[model samples]
Target: MSIEIPGYRSGTWVLDPAHSEVTFSVRHMMISKVRGTFGVKEATLIAPENPLEAKVEAKVDVSSIDTKDEGRDAHLRSADFFDVENHPVMTFTSTGTRVQNGDFLVDGDLTIRGITKPVTFEFDFGGFGKDPQGNYKAGASATAVIDREEFGLTWNAALETGGVLVGKEVTIGLDLQGALQV
Candidate 1:
């Protein structure tokens, strides 16, 4: 069966930062996962009929990385990790998209700490819905993994227990919802 996504016009659709966020998590000392979220400052999505032709541009405020713990969050914003002062924004742009078994695989360039790397995330299509005002909305969720060292966020400490303080692999989750303008 073919699913019809409400057609979007050929224009820029600004991401609703109020409802969107870029979050990540990593294994700490190989026993627990430490999670944090980055506030999205801006995003522009140009979705065409062909998923492969769809493009997304997003910018995240590095200074907004929050994990609820003041000390940990501060360290994440420092030079050892994100270095918010030097690299204030992390950005991403779609390169391609593919469908496998009815789900989307979105390939894109993810830039962090001045380093850009290609990453792919599996996406789930959330059907179009409408608000009380009759504005159409569509949503999707995706997840991908990244190497923190590859992005120059290589701060780590050796734990007496054996493993390092933080794991190299960082998992990212994206939950996006946008308004349709057709």
Candidate 2:
């Protein structure tokens, strides 16, 4: 079955940074998971004349990486991890877009710590509505799994029980909200 998304016109859609979030989770200590969020510096969606050709681009501030603990946050910002001082921003640019079985497959280039790789995320059109301020808003949720090592984030410690302190696989989640350009 096919359902048409609402308020998605052939025009630019500006991301609402205050309402959208990019978060991630990864296995920790081979037992549980650790989650965090990155601050989006900017994000925009250019609706192509052909709906399937839409492009989404975004920049995230590495310095805003937050996992709750200040000490761990500092370590993540250091060279051993994100090296936020040297690489302050990470970016993503969509190469292709398509609707499949009522969902969107956004194939894109993800750049992190100066390394770029192709990745695809499956997105669901959550809903569309008017915000409190009367702006027409579109909402979506996306998920993708990526290897930390692929992004040059291979730092880890050997666990006494046999695994590693951090898991190589990271699950990315995006709860996105955007408004149509007037």
Candidate 3:
């Protein structure tokens, strides 16, 4: 089967920061999950007539992490996690795209804390349409799970019970809205 978008066109699409969000979730306290959002500094999609041929590049501000807890957020920004002072930005660059079992997948390199690793994100296209301002827009969401330790984020506390305080797996998600450059 071939990938198809209802109104796909070739052009540059700039991410609408106000309508886009970068979120993440990680297992906390070996029982529950903690979620947060990051501020997107910038992102662009170089689209092609064939959606699978498109390329994407994005940058996220590491210091914008908000887990609803100031103290925990501060710790995440420190050397134990993101180390914002040294690595203020995390980035993703698409390398390729493919489809499997009727699902679209985007293969890319995700860099965090100065470490780069290949990751694949399952993508779901939310279709295309024109906004009230008459600008063409596209929407999509993608998600991927990664081992924090693979990115050098090995900080954790031993629990009195058995497991660690923080889970090693982290789920990263992106809800994006982009306007086609006219």
Query: Top model by lDDT, which number?
Result: 3
TM-score order, best first, reads: 3, 2, 1
Q: For model 1, how does the per-residue alpha-carbon lDDT over 87-177 read when each residue is reduced to its tens digit?
A: 9999999997777787778889999999999998988766567768887776777899999899998899999879899999999998887
Task: Score every model by TM-score.
Answer: 0.91, 0.93, 0.97
Local error of candidate 3 at residue 19 (angstroms) = 0.4
Off by over 4 Å in 2: 1-4
Q: Evaluated with TM-score, which candidate comes out highest?
A: 3
Q: For model 1, state the Cα shift of residue 163 in Å.
A: 0.9
Task: Write model 3 residue lDDT over 24-131, tens digit each, in one string.
Answer: 999989789999999999999998878788899999999999999999999999999999999999999999988999889999999999999999999888989999
lDDT of 2 by residue, 66-147 (tens): 9998998899899988989889999999998877776679999999999999999999888878888888788899999999
lDDT minimum window of 10 residues, candidate 2: 1-10
TM-score of 1: 0.91
lDDT score for candidate 3 against the true structure = 0.94
Give the lowest summed-lDDT range of ten residues in model 3.
1-10
